[model samples]
Target: MRHQDERPEAPWAATNRPPMGWNSWDSYGTTVTEAEVLANARFLAGHDEGVLAAAGWDTVVVDIQWYEPTARPGGYNDDAPVLFDDHGFLQPVPARFPSSAGGRGFAPLASAVHDLGLRFGLHLMRGIARRAVEADLPVPGTPYRTGEIADTSSTCPWNSDCYGLRHDHPGAQAWLDAMVDHVVGWGVDFLKVDDMLAPYHRDAVEALSLAVRRAEQRHGRRVVVSLSPGTELSLAHLEHLREHADLWRVSDDLWDRWPDVEAQLGRMARWAPHSGPAGWADADMLPLGRIGVRAERGEPRHSLLTTDERRALLSLWCLARSPLFVGGDLPTSDAATVADLAHPGLLEVAHRSGGGRELLREGPTGAETAVWGAATPDGATRWVGVFSTAAEARRVRVPAAAAGLPGAPDVVVDVWSGERVPLASAGPATGGDTVLDVEVPAHGVRLLRLGTRAHSGTPGPEEHTWQG
Candidate 1:
């Protein structure tokens, strides 16, 4: 039992750690079938010793366009035929999700996932579906029609599925409340509301948060809120985000490219300081394993990133304490990727450590490594993430005093390997100060836990073969 002060202070502190899960977008795009989702859920549930669930990777999110009956691979079908009920609430496509037939919606799917001991999530764009507005369906428990609440002029720039809502309209709040009511009843515990952060749609964001809170109070269930496609989410909105969301993306959709992964080092550095029990700055999903099967942006293949790069991708997310959603089919992903997902030492930093902050980003573009530091929840020890942002291999000499690390670390444990990092020499070439030089490959990362001993009773290492 946690003490009062040790407990998280967020209004909805039930979910203090980053929400970790498997997202369907990278593997199947908007075309995933119910069977595919269940298969992934079964893997993540980890009947096999509960490996992933034990690591705090437990949510299963059905990504965007689930309501489109004929949604396909490669990209969104412009003006897709979206399914909705008479109440203006979106429903899962019966063709793709057979259990959603007979007006059941996602009830059966959510039930199946719940039985496996995982939270169920759905991805929906902000505002009302244009199809629902065109149909003029009545809002449940309200006299208003969907058309009366929709702001037709405010449409998504990239997707034609939705039109922004007029927040001032009484019908708008009713619409969102009714929508949240429907999903919460279906056992939806996580909601990913997209198309709001790229330009920071303040009104839409608040409306949804209010809707979710109302629904939670009415139903006695918690729904985690996540906003996305953070093209340029400003720091000025940090307070607003904390009041509303459990997490928000700090960067755009991250894929399996070194540039995509490298770009996040800067974004996470800026956002990590604000992360804590209150909220998380999502670096976006880990596009490791067998991705691009029916992905929106790429052809069928395993992740394009190398072994070192893949480790770096997951490592950076851990260091930033970003939400840990995987964008690959777990059952079909490579063994290395699967094992990486179950790393307890790596996940401990993401789950139980204090907020992370960037210490240094050295050298020129594509030829540098950045250092970031964060502490254990107890605040007695420190963990550091050293990232290689280079286009080639190089040795990074980290001066203890200059980089804000311990000159003589009580412990030098590798987060990935779970073995001790040998500090044969502890200074720069000048020997002016204590330093630890680690050779990192292009776009790779080395996560180390230094200072006092690791947490007591923390599980053993997740067993990684990667080295600096």
Candidate 2:
């Protein structure tokens, strides 16, 4: 079915840009504490003209295992007692988050983040907690026990903390509704639900969507519903995802590696048609700066990706309009990393452009160079990206027609360097179309802003040139 036929209107019209934020997974893993979260929040909202603040990064997300009292850096104790209320709704571990004591939940932390001019978010698993089911806790507003609504046969493949909900049971919806109510009360602005999308669990996704909608109606709050670990979903499921989630992961946990980054080019192309103001195709978190400080996957160190590779990653993500979640330890990041994250041109394309599309993909089967284009929000200019996916440096040419520019653009500025690149030919071409040629290093990218003519009284090409 068509997107419009599946949904009457954009369910998440409130969200216009892809959500940008700092998530705790790559930096602190499952052991991130309240102090660490606050430190990052402080840096994000710091008055020192930080990169995060300058780049409009406004969300602070606490990733998985926040409720597990015995959670450690590299592992999780699934059998350990989790912090939850009598109604089976999870809460932060007070030992790690003292503010959540006295049955206050995350309201205190969320309020602090709000005070800093940012939104707060949390990570959650798919269904009822195993502990709640074992205890047979009563479903809120209903007499049915947790076991009645829990689907014992359905469990997350990677985590042992929860069982999927039985959609056939009325109590399942009630349980989900109560969970949303509690989180909404905690002032959550976003929720990343994991283990629900990778396998394309339609029943659970629909149930959670209904529960979130009901909670929004009841409390008048907007929470961006994000589904996680999108490694297996197909194009056939696009409508279902758009109808349910504000953002959904388009790839697995993307890390700091060239192959993983290279693989996303095609994934983004396939998912691009489904992305828009209402729903985004998330190209997971950017693992730059100080990652794996306390991670499960690898030892603590700076990202292995070269500076050029990092730029390519960011450029492609912007061209695709994917959600930007920085997975670095912000307080410890170096000055260069911060400056890279604050590139104004890339941020503008990411947040202010529309109609992103891949214009070209050519070369051998595995060693292709790709070009992508998107128009500025006002349609006055076009942003173009040329990426080299080969093992060696390659020269790429993007024709003006392919880039969606009217005629041959009189002005073309490198987005990163701000240097005006002289067109190969001055006026319209006689025999062939005008093309912009760029030499991109292996796994590197070149971004350009094209316009028919320079803005009136705008600085001359040399004036805006970046020395670096």
Candidate 3:
């Protein structure tokens, strides 16, 4: 890992806040068509009547296998025949993306998305395409073949579409440079590179980061670079991670299961300190809304998680300040799910606060109350997320001082329900600290925002009481 002082300045990392967007993986798998992408982009950008656009959901990503013409739903076609150009660069299969028929690539689709007031992103399997190396295609603008620069020994375990690059080879970085330049030329505002971190490929990560920087410099276009599938990501890589990609996944694909949501409690606690601007430790995509329409996992339906579980999931992500990428198909989702995502108060925590971290997590294994806290940059307002990871409903309480606030807040507004939960005076045990006592449903969360001063903001009209 390189020292912090030695790292080059990355203007691309100036994305100063975690990005919020929609991704096609969960709903369309590897088979998402240009039409499907446009539908989701339209929903995100309000090409029709999407409310999420104004709520900060601005980027739309077409995830994985865009070049395989024969790609289908369920799972990737093993050793599939994917298409790339004579220069060893993958091209969107015209069969799936008709606009790319004349080697136009994603330019037209990206233009359509930009016209809707949203950014366009694409997912690339890290390294050179396997078939391109097999075909021994020449690395464009280089006097070398793709096979000569590919390290065939390193390949994805679950997918055989690509092989790792031989960083020692001079043409290795050249190939990445050309490919990145090609993709970014299509007006791609964000780029996701997968199969980079499962085994922690340091050299590949550095090369790819340099490639993105090189391309952005050449095209005078900014692109957010994300690394993924961090199955067992370690905190030791913090400095290196910050110097490279915009946001890197801290865990493998998080789905809409309670256990999946439960597991992130520890990951977020460990990684939140390093999350800010372009250097976030991603908790994976929010698997809410309607997932599994034609996914790599499960059958088509609304998310398997209950309403309470979904609330906990989003609250955890926002309070921890992780990036938000909805894994579900947005256009086909129900109104309630859509509204929950676009809620003003909930998003404010992610957009307006700082100092996000886990305050404490106590109680038994299945009955834990995890508290996470954050505040506005000026520290005038604070946010707390009280989560119930129990098998049944329970009342949890935490003192304002313990929650790291200046004192008892003038008003405590629940970010989710927009209701007021008045602070209660505690006895001698807590040293006279005011506390918030409330009944939290099993697998549910109470996301709270505090005004340390007099009425900085008021809660919604509806009032709810947990106890007197």
Candidate 4:
């Protein structure tokens, strides 16, 4: 294990905030087509003044199985031949992505997305394609053959499409370099590398990171690398993670159920301390609006969570400062769903705030409530999130002192409602001992922005409300 101070400096220093985007996985899964991807990209890149574009949701990521010719919902053909170039580099399946037919690859689609003023990304599994190894193809810019670099003994536990590369093999780094160069030419802005971090493939991650850095230097492009499906990672590996990728998952796939959302409270808390400007602990994609429309996990349907649950989910993710990857079919999303994603207050907390930390978590079994807090960019205001995990409505309270906001706050704005919530004394306390009490609906949240007396003025009638 490397000490915090002994770790190498991070390769990519341009990621100032967590990424905000829409992914094709939760909604379209392995069977997502080029037409579907373009539709979502159009939805995200709506008129320059559209809600999504205005909220800085400018990335459109095409998830896994894009190279498979016969991919479908809930099924993967492990025996299907993997597609690759003569140099052992993977390419899009022309049958599925027609634009890539004349060996143009994703360049045409990437240009289309770029024309819409949106960034394009792709999902990739770690290691070399199994078929490439079997074919004994040459690795571009390297003297060794693909078979020489392949580590036949190591493979993904769940997917058989690829074989792990041997870190000791002389051609491993060259192979990665070739792969990165290919994507760089295609204008990929982000690369969500899966099956690497979850199983702690340190050598592969390091090789890939270095390859990305080298490719960026060679092509003069910045491609954000994100690790996915991080089921479990030790605190000792925090330095390594930050040194390699821009974003790494903190939990496994988080679905649309309340339980999945509730489980993230603890995961986020545990990983919060490790999150910073260089790297973030992803809580997985947001499963809201219409989802699983041909997904591998379940049948197509609208999100199962209630409106309040959706709000809580966004509140928690924003307060935790996790990367926001909207996972629904954007084109089919309702107006209300779009409004939720476009909320300025939530976006502020997610992209501009800092020093986020868990404050309180307490309640009886099956009815717990949790509190998370973060400092606004200017540090004059505090963004707080109070979540009710119960099935029944609950009154959640937090003393100003507990929230690190000393003295009486002149105004407390409910982020979602844009209404001012009145503060009252918790008990026999006086002055600065005031506590805020608000009724949070079951599976709901109260996202508040605290304005201190010194920095705030009296609120108008329309802005003031007492829910206690």
Whose lDDT is greatest here?
3
TM-score leader: 3
Indicate the TM-score of model 2: 0.91
Residue 20 Cα positional deviation in candidate 4, in Å, after optimal superposition: 0.7
User: Please, what are the lDDT tens digits per residue for candidate 1 over residues 1-468?
Assistant: 112232224332543467788999999998988999999999988746788886677889999999988888888788888888887688898889999999998999999999999999999998888888999888777788888999999988889999999999998988888888889899998999999898899898888887887777777767888899888889999988887777898887888888998898888888988876677888998898898888898888899999889888787777777888998988888888787777767776766566578888878887877888877654456777788877777787777755566466777788777777766564346376667667777778778888666432253464221111
Candidate 4 minimal-lDDT segment of 10 residues: 459-468
Alpha carbon lDDT of each predicted model: 0.81, 0.81, 0.84, 0.80
Q: Which residue pairs collide, candidate 1? A: 426-435, 427-435
- Rank order by lDDT, top first? 3, 2, 1, 4
- Screening candidate 2 with a backbone cut-off below 3 angstroms (N, C-alpha, C), the clashing residue pairs are none
Q: After aligning candidate 3 to the native by TM-score, how far in Å is the CA of 173 from where it should be?
A: 0.9
**lDDT of each residue in 311-385, candidate 4, tens digit only:** 998988877878888889987876687788888777767655677878888887679978888875455677778
Q: List the residue pairs that clash in candidate 3.
A: none
1-468 per-residue lDDT for model 3 (tens digits): 323333344332432347889999988889888999998888787733666876679999999999988888888888999888888888998878999989899999999999998889999988888888989988877899988999999999889999999999989999998889999999998999999999999999999888887777788767888899999999988888888878999998988899999999989999997788648789999888888988889899899888899989988898888999998888888777888888777776666666789998898887899999987666667888889899788888788776887777777877777678888887887788888888898899888878843232322354221110
* Model 1 lowest lDDT segment of ten: 1-10
The residue ranges of model 2 lying beyond 4 angstroms of the native Cα positions read 1-16, 78-80, 426-431, 452-468
TM-score per candidate, in order? 0.92, 0.91, 0.93, 0.92
lDDT score, residue 459, model 2?
27
